[model samples]
Target: MDLTTYAILLAGALAGGFVSGLSGFGTAVMALGIWLYILPPAIAVPLVLICSVSSQISTLPSMWKVLDFKLAGPFVAGGLVGMPIGALLVARADPQNFKLSVGVMLLVFPTALYFIRKPMAFRFGGRPADAAIGFAGGILGGLAGLSGPLPTLWASIRGWTKDQRRGVFQIFNGSVLGAALILQIASGFVKWDVFWLAMLALPGTLIGARLGMRTYHALNDRNFYDVVLALLFLSGIGLVWSSIAPR
Candidate 1:
């Protein structure tokens, strides 16, 4: 990669890592956007996988105490089953259709958040609901790397505490994303030329996670939720625009 490309990758990694550290997601969206400008979407996806795994592993330790392991299993199981299918679809999908779909999702997600009432406590509707949400997350993750929002929506409906929600979601993402990365690697989506880029971004990921934990402690529950919603909306729009105007 040229110096300009290296700069873009580094900047994207730092920004994405910081956001994810604070919110438990968005690293892939951020990195993918920058990389898409310099690489094919197929290559961008695996590169994103590498970056996400690095970021999540760094963040997982501090948040480990807050993770809801019981709820994570079903979600992981469903994601493992569904992600490959989504990947297959992405491999064959028209780029224009992908942009349109992302645009629609961007417009819909924030509005959906506004209507949902937060529950008083954590409510797992049983294994069925868990499995269903997991499956939904996996499919979306595979197709667009946008799976975090679905589970976040479910968690919001159940009224999980901010730490609990973030921790659980990270665990869920780590499991599903780890598997997806393996598939992506096998398909040769990850390029050797970018391996160093992924490694170089690791420090940013670590810094971001630490900052995020601090931010999580500083914000009240309501403010934290609001911030997450806003990030989701903005990132969705950014992804849609990137796919459409990819420069």
Candidate 2:
């Protein structure tokens, strides 16, 4: 790998880990949006998973008390059920189309949520809705190393408190993404090339996570959401345009 590749890897890992630290989810979306422009989906997907897992390890423990395992259980189960199907799809997908789809995924969700003046907290969905969202998150997670957006969006719409949202998606993502990584291994996507790249990214991930956690404390709730959505929106546009541009 070239120095550029190494630099991009560290950059993505740092930014993604920072977001994950602040919001308790989003490691993959942030990272994959950057990586897909340079790396193939097969390599990028599992690499994002590794970075996601590391960010989780770095951030989860300090906030563990706020997490409610029971609250996250259904979502995790649903994600487990949906992961295999997503994993199956990637091997057959056109790489460009896969990137396009991920770009669209990144683009659409943030746009929709940006307009909300306050947490919507729709009354209808409840636990069943949560599970369904988790199932979808699993598919995305497996397919594009993105397991957080749907669940995170849903939680935000539900008007969950910061801790509540963090607790659920953080645990949900960790469980689902962990499973996705194992699936990648079994499917032969976890090679030494990706492994070494992940190793190179470890310091960046940890440092970013630490910095993000500190920033999370300093920023008020609204500021945090604004920054998160803004980054996603811009990255989404970049990924989409890249995927669709003529070679």
Candidate 3:
């Protein structure tokens, strides 16, 4: 590949890893948004999947104690069913339209959440509701490499404590992203270019994740959330611009 591709991969990896390490998700939101500027969705999606796994693993030790298997189970189960369908759709999807749709979601989802601020709490907290959201997340994960939005929103709506929210987000994303990587491999999407890109990205993922975790420990909950929203809004704008710009 050319220097441009290499530069994009490295830059995306570093930024994505830092965001995900700090927030328990948003690796794809940051990475894929930038990657889509140069790489097609097929390549960009799988690359994010691989790097997401790296980020998750690096930070696993920090959040290990807080994980609640019971709380994360329903979402994991639903994602198992939804991911393959999304992968199939990815294979057939129109590249420009898919990129545009993802860009729109990136822009709209964060903006809506920012404006809604302190949404009415969901009282039920039912397994079924969690599962439904997970299913949506899985489909998005499979299609555009974005599975964290629904779960993140749900966790916020539930008003979970920081540890509680981290537990759910990390576990759910770890499971789904791992599965997505495997599916991509089976579908012949993980080739040499992706492998080399991933290799070059490893250090950035490691370094950024370490820094992010430190930041996560220092920030207050409200401030952390604000930072995440700002990042999402910016990433969304990047994707939108990439979708419309000339190749």
Candidate 4:
């Protein structure tokens, strides 16, 4: 790759890594825009899975104390069920309208999140609601590399503690994205060149994640929630920009 493409690759990795590290998800929103400019969707999409999973792995130790498999189980099960369906629908969907609609929600929802005087914990719907949300996230992830928002939004609404929210989405995103990566590999998406690109991404991903974790640890639960909402807002902007930009 040329120096410019190489630069863009690492920049995307680092940016996405930082967000994923801090928020437990969002690699696609942060990285795919720039990555798409340099690499085809075939390469860019799988590379996102690789770097995102890598970033999640590097930050796992911090999350272990808060992570609970029982809490994340239903979501994962729902995601697995939805994953293949997403793969089937990707080609048939109207990409622009779909993204624009999601982008608008991303923009609108975060504004509501910002207005909450305190973390408003809702108690209704529980596990079944979570599974349905996870199913939606899985479809979005598999379709557009956009999975974290729904779960993250739900967690916040559940009035979870910061770490609780973090742990659920981290485990949820990692499991779903990891499974997606495996599907990609089995489908022959990981060619030697893509592997090489991922290798180059490793250092930047780790560094960005490390830095993000440091910031993560520095914040109180409330500050972290605000940061996540801010990131979501920016992600909305990115989505809107990409949907309208030249492919």
Candidate 5:
């Protein structure tokens, strides 16, 4: 990639990493938005995965204490089962239609969260429900390179403490991202070019994540949610617009 492309990718990584560090989600949305404009979706997805996983690792040390392994475990298991299917769908499916579907889903998320005030707990009714959510998350993860929002929403409804929510989300994302990278490699979606780009973005990712963590500590819960909601809404609109506009 040229200097301009590299610059763009680095900027996106910084922005996405910061968001992920603060909110435990939004890295993919932030990075993918710019990356897709520069690279094919297939390559963009994997590249974003690489950066995201790296950021998660950086934040893992601090988040370990609050990590909800029990809740994360089942969701990850389901993601593993679902990702391969999503990969296949992405490979064969029409890009436009898939974008439209993803856009609709993105739009629906904030709306549902807005209206649904009843908070639920994270404890699954059973293994089946846990597995089901994982499967769904994995499928979406593989296809759109975004699977955290669904599980994050689920966790939020459960009234998880902020730290617990962050820990659960980071673990879930890290696992799915690892699996998705492997599948993408096997499927030939991951290329040397993309790998290089991800490597180039690593420094920025680390810096951004640390900065975000600092910022997160400074913000109150209400302020944090306000920021996250605004970002999510804006990112959703961007995705929807990119889906409809002529390529």
Candidate 6:
């Protein structure tokens, strides 16, 4: 690729990494939209997965203590089941329409969550329900390389504490994206250009993640939630615009 493409990919990686570092999610929501402007979905999806895993692993040392199996286990099980189905769709679907639908849902659901005066105080689902959400997340991951939004929203609705939410976000994203990356590799979607771009993008990812983590540490729960809502809103806008943008 050209210098311009390299610059854009690195810049997108920085933004996406920072967001993932802060919230333990949104790597795809943040990066894929920007990358899509220059790359096809076929290349963009694998690149998103690769960079997302990179951003997520950078936070493990700090986040490992907060992970809760009871919360993440069933969801993971569901996600594992849903991923193959999503991957299959990747080969034979109208990606723009599918993404547009997801984009609309992302906009509507989070907006409603933000407006409610009295947010619920307790976790909202049983293991089965969590698994179902995970499965849906997996399908999205498979189809569009976006797995974080559904789980992130579910965690918000459940009213989890910051640590609880972060733990889920990181663990869930890592698991699903890692699985998708493996599938992508097996399918030969990862090309030399993807590898070289990832290498170039790495330093920016490290810097952005550190900065984001610092910001995350400074925020109170309310402020953190507000940030998440804003990020989700931006993610929705990005998705919608990408879906409708001229090719």
Best model per TM-score = 6
RMSD of each: 2.5, 1.8, 1.8, 1.7, 2.3, 1.5
Which model, 1 or 6, shows the larger lDDT?
Answer: 6
Candidates 2 and 6 compared: the better one by TM-score is 6
- C-alpha lDDT of residue 174 in model 2: 90
* Candidate 2 lDDT for residue 222: 71
Q: Which stretch of 10 consecutive residues in model 3 shows the poorest summed lDDT?
A: 116-125
Candidate order, lDDT descending: 6, 4, 3, 2, 5, 1
Q: Count the backbone clashes (under 3 Å) in each candidate.
A: 2, 0, 0, 0, 5, 0
Candidate models: Cα lDDT each = 0.73, 0.81, 0.82, 0.83, 0.76, 0.83
Give the lDDT of residue 83 in candidate 6.
Answer: 83
Residues 85-142 of candidate 2: C-alpha lDDT, one tens digit per residue = 8888888878677667767876788888888776576757778888999999899888
Residue pairs clashing, model 5: 78-134, 78-135, 79-134, 120-157, 120-158
* Pairs of colliding residues, candidate 3: none
User: Tens-digit lDDT track for model 4 on 43-152?
Assistant: 77778888988989999998899898898888888887777676566557676677678778889998898998675889788899889989998987776667788888
Root mean square deviation (Cα) for candidate 1: 2.5
lDDT of 6 by residue, 117-213 (tens): 4766655567788999999999888776788889888888787888888888888888988898898889876888888777877787777777888
The runs of at least 3 residues in candidate 4 whose Cα sits more than 4 Å from the true structure, single-residue gaps closed, are: 91-95
- Predicted candidate 5 versus true structure: per-residue lDDT over 25-102, tens digit per residue: 778877776666677886777887888888888888878888888867888888888988987887787766666676
Model 3 TM-score relative to the real fold? 0.92
Candidate 2 clashing pairs, residues 3+ apart or interchain: none
Q: Choose 1 or 5, whichever is better by lDDT.
A: 5
Q: What are the runs in model 6 whose C-alpha is more than 4 Å off?
A: 122-125
Question: Considering summed lDDT, which 10 consecutive residues are worst modelled in model 4?
Answer: 87-96
